[model samples]
Target: MSSNLPKNFPGRPASAPTPSEVPAPAPSAALPKNFTPEMARAAAALQAGAATAAGQAPSSGAAAAEQPAAQARGQAAMPGGPEVTRGEIADHFAQRIVRMVDAHRGDSSRPRLYAIEFPFTDFEFDVAYALAGRLGATLSASDAAVDDDEPARPLVMLDRVLNNPQQFERIVRHINHGQDVQLVCTRAWQLPQSVADLVDATLTIPRFDAPRFAAACVDFYELGAPPALGADADWVPNVVPRDFLLNSQVARSDIVSAVRQSVERRLRRYATDDALDLADLAGMDEAHDWARALIDEVALARSGAISWDDVGGRVILLGARGVGKTTLARAIARAAHLRYVEASASDWAPPQNEPQLGWMRMNAAFQEAMAAAPALFFVDDVDAFSIAPWAGMLPAFLEQLKGLSADDRVVLIAGAQSAEHVRFELHRRGALETTLTMPAPNSQALAKMYSVLLRGSGSTLAQADLEHIGLLSLGMTGHEVELIVRRALRRARKDGGRDVSKEDLAQAIIEQRVGPESQDRRRLMAADELRNTAYHEAGHAILELMRTRGARLRYASIIPRENGSLGFVLPGVDESRNSVTRNDIVEMVRVALAGRAAEEVFSGPEGTTSGCSNDLQQATAYLRYLMTRSGFHGLLSLDRSFEDSPELRERAESMLQAEYAHVLGLLQRHRPLLDSVAKLLIERQEVSGDELTRVVDAYRSSHPLV
Candidate 1:
């Protein structure tokens, strides 16, 4: 074996043979005269197998090679060692090449071309090199010139062509100029469109596994015996260690150990040392199932029981920030026992004056993830990575993304606030095609979270109180609920370490959502102003109850919020209703304007305070939507620009006037009910939905409308 051979040379020695010896060439020798004895030995073993199958006898020198050659042949015939073995990817390519040769024998009608694609492993090109040697083909990376005496051999290009336009053009030129050369492309994502146009057929190789690894080792090294393959030997990542392994003087017995150590050094550690399990993720039923399925499939893939394509590990989690997308990704990594690598898209974005930096950062991140095979590669805020096709870094970014998608060892999980704004190309095949939307936890989900939090805290809240707290925390994320629970627990601790009460949780929710109540404002405001604020909120609540198509009122309060609001009336949307009609729009407008109408009903039109300004703005917005977008006034959907027209302006004024008059008349007719609710609001400062409902129902029963 020669030490001067290229590291990627077919049958390059893993460890050098003694300098004192000259090796014998076997009967199967078919390599060119200048080839190293080591390559000749490997090629001989493969060729002898083919020759023996065809009933050829060995030469005298081949008799000297008989024992070892037969052992090599037997190794190739078995399930796991050497390049020419059945079921090995190299064997499949060999058969394909043989078929192509037979099909094109002595024919000069077309360019003899064969292309195949495979997800690249570290030693994939070596497979091509061995195949080329066995079949008398030319390697693109080989320096040896083909002998002018022999017939031209097929040109095998296992190296990447997409990134090298010059080499691609040369290949295209050779084909177009009627050269008598055959082209074989062993590695491709897909042939470049121009090359695809000329290709007659394309084939794909199966994914890499333990058997593939064993075959690759035999081709690259002179192992004393088949490399010992553990159950998870395939879990070792294929990276750049082949260069070092080929250059070093590692013993045959130590070769697999050295490679495993290199993989261990390259592997990443989980970012969070202590990640939560799937059971810890409450209120995310769909997300739980998604993560669990991934965990199971990943386990199967790691054990070589299935391929990563079967796992389908690339996915994007769509949700608002803090909706637990990151948490879910980490949990999946933990559950599957895979290396966890997380990077934010913003982290990869280029800084000032460095447009190419973004792609470089993204490429580095991908490299790190690939080094750590069986890894969870998470990109947070992936929506930020979205860029226009014309952007300077888009090509490089996509190229790096293409590499990540092609590799099966790294499970890619990306998070985005929404998918609508993400780059359309990012959603193309082999990228973030699988989208999982994580919605904010609803009331029932919130209840489950509260229950979990309470149990973890060693405190108990009555089931009814949990339900109430959950209802009050509607539309909140699990993160928000967690924080609110923490605040409530703190409140309980401050109050002599008692169990968290419903009031404590409710107060925490109020403080978090609306801001703390303004005790200073309550004390400083005039009595008359307080009365007016109460009545204004009361009016909104009353009209909300009266409107047939409006949202259900959650609560009404006269307590000033720290956000500079004198009062607020919270309403919850009915999730069951998927669509709204014209009348529903009118009803919403009436609710928006009810406070102004009530202020005028109590304090004459001139006496109404500026408190109705916000109410008027809300009413105007809803009315604008109704008049323009909803086609409330005419058949045509007019824009707000038409508000300048005299006819449209008059129509808008009449609509507002009529809606206001209608609400005022109702406030007048329901005067007793409005006053009662206002009195209750003034007494309680905040009124619950049940309390307001009771007042309204009592009033309606006593004063039936005609």
Candidate 2:
């Protein structure tokens, strides 16, 4: 049967109705439909008093005003009398016990009784049951007849009628009539003024006992005993006896042995050669040798018995997305013969009575796994766990790590996108141990990944194709490489096992490439932008060539490709040349402005492209460098900080404005060359460096740079 129940004390027997229930107290009938301003103020005051009694904040105005008038009426009806609802009764008893305890503070010799009160609702019942189980107490319904044989454990009343003030009054009367029991309640209801007067001085529930409440629920539901609480004998594994694998020189073999035993116990089933071959299980063999080596190293380390103090307790495999952090973690678990438990940080939350039941279960599992020792607790995507200020039990989670001992065989491996964040959190908690970063797969690694996929599918991929795949997968990680190979296999399967062709691979690469369909469009726009950029670069190249005969323009072209550069000009110059003259700097500025000038003269100002954002930034920085560091500004000779000076900044801006104007006029005079070059680019879409050099040479033959 579902363990659902309401959160309140059972109502009084119908046959013997109390005065609070019969003759309908007259004050309730006279209560207002809505609280008057004065009444609202009074209710707020009462709510505050009640909250203070419960050690919580008062409800807001809307909530305070909406409470059933029956609460206030019940209080008014029992100014000094004996009538009240089950809720008020629970509050009254709780208050009395609190008062007794307060009056007897520091007098432990006095009779001690603890009462827990909750509404009999399903959530409250679960909480009560959990608390009872944790406290090792027996729980009975409020109406269950108590026999002499029943253990006299502390009583917790689950009263459903605690919200009804009339019913609560009778409960208080029952308690007052010499029932030697502590009182507790789940819901907050108005307490009588007399009861409120004594609350602060009398009753309190300690915050540390919250977990006990959680444990109670777990036990009440028979969720099964937490693994931490299970008998140690139950954890023993059926494995063949083996000698202690240890380095005799290491004094910490005892510690290592404990951890090894713990790990072996949990993973006894996977302690075979076949089980160690997880690479094959994962359909990967290109890196089979590497995988085998890693396994062998782990096995050797396990056998060699390094001292516990020298051995690292935790291993972190850090890498960019999809580099097999999880895969490595699983392999480690298999290698160590430990149970692998995977959980995400996003899956945990602060314990709540109802909603947090699942988190409690997880907590139980975590503790159980830890107690089992020598286990691999793989926490995946741990970066997603949130920390909030109001979370009361957050420290408990962190405390679990703090409590780990050298004897504990628990090895926690957490995965995240960035090691920095995880390291920061661990450092803040002082829990970090050892870390290992996984690098992006190199070309050889990519080739291996490809070969593995191909061999697994019984298809052969050529070495040239593998090289091409490696080149294309430059920045990819192990996981991404595997995924790409898997995708290729899927494609091969779709084509009926036909040999995967270069065309098929190219198609896949294009599909995987960013902005595939937009490639042509982007290229077109980039080419237009490049045409203008080429003219600008040509202006600089021509100016330099004229000023310094040795400054030869080797090649210039407008071609659009990845990295967003539209046009480039390569000057055949010494690679070691770093410093340039003032004239050279001026020519560079002229080149920077050439594209803008060419667009204005040939394609009109409307033809200017947004692709010049980078160019403009580069040109501005160069101009500033000249003014500040290179001392190219004719009148202003200052340090690098000169760019920040208003005078130098204005002069630099003016110089660039004048240079751009001059370049624009020069482009207008040479409009035919600009048009011819642009036409060639539009026709061919792309031009080789040689083709561009020929075009420039022809233009210069007719119109010299000078």
TM-score of each: 0.61, 0.43
Question: lDDT per residue, candidate 2, 611-639, as tens digits?
Answer: 55665676777787787667555566556
Residue 560, model 2: Cα distance from true site in angstroms: 13
lDDT of each: 0.65, 0.48
**What tens digits encode model 1's per-residue C-alpha lDDT throughout 55-157?**
9864333234323333344443422322232213333344445555556555546765556543334434544544554444445542223233333344556
- Clash totals for all candidate models: 0, 36
Give the least accurate 10-residue stretch of model 2, judged by summed lDDT. 17-26
Candidate 1 lDDT score at position 22? 15
Task: For candidate 1, give the lDDT.
Answer: 0.65
Local error of candidate 1 at 127, Å? 29
Name the weakest run of 10 consecutive residues (lDDT summed) in model 1: 18-27
